[model samples]
Target: MDTDTIDGQPRVVATDAALAFIDEIRKDYPDILFHQSGGCCDGSSPMCYPADDYIVGDRDVKLGEIGGVPVYISASQFEVWRHTQLIIDVVPGRGGMFSLDNGRERRFLTRSRMFDGGEACAIPLVKRG
Candidate 1:
């Protein structure tokens, strides 16, 4: 769907630097997806995985798009973080073990800002699909 479908209030967006990094990685893995890990192994971070390697399930919530890629979070996590807009950025560091960003020395991070009334109104609460 085109971005307009979300009323132009993107729930997830990426910085120019992060998009550049993602574009570079696209050379190796054409199809990629992002999942915000709820903690534990990944410690509540945004993790990138090849489409074929990861599966979106009933317990996941599609927050929105980031650099044309779908971004998801566990249903439980969404319940706690649904009020803020996510800014996906890249930082220098090792990525989570199972994430595609690992070994690149650049990791995906989520920097969020609470939505204003307009944005909050435009953004719907993530429901299970």
Candidate 2:
């Protein structure tokens, strides 16, 4: 499910704060992954989990890597956001209780900006594998 290209502008990227936060958390939990959860109590945010802990099913699509952490979205959610570049950022809040960043007063978020025609054509669409 890794659809990365050397010259391609990634479909996803992480902010500096998000990267630092991930680094700090990774100290205790080395292998981590993120799943884009649908809108619910978590508000359509990305949920972090230990690698291979949250099973990646057939309906999930791999977006790209952010801070060396792989990110994915449910098929349904991807359909709605496929045209944009996903930006993972951190902001002050109580995150999903089960997510590693929950108690840190900062949570992983999914921010996005629609891609222009050229960028859209350049980004790769990753299907479930």
Q: Write down the RMSD of all candidates, one decimal each.
A: 2.7, 2.7
Task: Give lDDT for model 2.
Answer: 0.82
Assess the local accuracy of residue 57 in candidate 2 as a C-alpha lDDT between 0 and 100: 77
Candidate 2 clashing pairs, residues 3+ apart or interchain? none
Clashes of 2: 0
List where candidate 1 sits over 4 angstroms from the true fold: 1-7, 121-123, 126-129
What TM-score quantifies how close candidate 1 is to the native fold?
Answer: 0.86
Error of 1 at 32 (Å): 0.7
- Residue by residue across 30-124, what tens digits does model 2's lDDT show? 99999888866778788999996889978878888888888888887887887777889999998897888889888988888888867666655
TM-score of each: 0.86, 0.86
Pairs clashing within candidate 1? none
Tell me the lDDT of model 1 at 94.
95
lDDT of each: 0.81, 0.82
